[model samples]
Target: MEVDHLFEIGDKIVYPMHGAGVIKAIEEKEIQGKTQQYFIMVFPVRKLQLMLPIAKMDDSGMRLVLNMTAIEKVMDMFRQGEIDRSLTYKQRYKINTDKMKTGKTQDGAEVIRDLMLVKKEKALNSNEKMMLREAMQFLISELELSNSMTEMQAADLLNDRLNVEKDAG
Candidate 1:
């Protein structure tokens, strides 16, 4: 049975942790003798495919791509922020991980912003380094779809104004 859904084919959306992708199909497959509808999405840049069960979509932390205006606000967030050095690294990582799981562009930008600030002071541990890398890729992926930017263009945008010094000399 074909039914209309909130998202349709060709719609672009962000799947938390996997980045942005275009919905290619809504398919029903029989698994464990049960048939269920799934959204099949393709991440162009990464050449990755993901299947999201319709019943579980809301719980998956997936979201539609941000519009240009909201994306601009996210960029602003990346440009403004101070790290809380008081917390231990584990606590910080837990908070950042929670932010990433929100599937909100603003939270991802905040994670990136806080980590970049930490980087300016000292090196990030292996886990922090990996978190930073994943967050960066996710940001760039969403930015590309939001503004119709090439991956390179999106990356360049992220780098711009990122070298700000908190204290003016």
Candidate 2:
């Protein structure tokens, strides 16, 4: 039987709060007496795999990895995105967490930009530090597939851009 698939094998898609992965297979699985088509994907950088029911792809918040032009635009936004220093810790954390849920590369970049700027002023609390790490990983995962960058290359490029403000300061 032909399967109606939102993403086929070899497609790069990002799952919100989970990072990005490449679709590796489509298989039919029986669970709780329900047989359904699922897409299997491997997340290379994070060294993980995921299987999602094809019917629930939209609910899962999966989207195609940013294309070349879009990725470039995101990079520019990352560099230009401003940090609001007046927000209380509670407010900032809430905003950042909401961004992560959006699963947009741009939102992830904004989280990095805001927290990194905060770090430059004062050490991040444990929660902020963890958020920064996860944001960086998520951003890197997308860059790897969307921009054809190695992990090191993506990390270096982000670090380099993050340092632009430091040089000017």
Tell me the tens digit of each residue's lDDT in model 1 across 37-74.
Answer: 99999997788998888989878987889887888776
Off by over 4 Å in 1: 2-4, 164-169
* Per-residue C-alpha lDDT of model 2 across residues 55-167, encoded as one tens digit per residue: 89878889999886787677676546566878999999999999999999989988988887788789999999999999999988888888888989988877786677557
TM-score per candidate, chains pooled = 0.92, 0.91
Which residue pairs collide, candidate 1? none
Model 1: weakest 10-residue lDDT segment is 160-169
What are the per-model numbers of colliding residue pairs? 0, 0
- Worst 10-residue stretch by lDDT in candidate 2? 74-83
Candidate achieving the largest lDDT: 2
The RMSD (Cα, Å) of candidate 1 is 2.0
lDDT of all the models against the reference? Answer: 0.84, 0.86
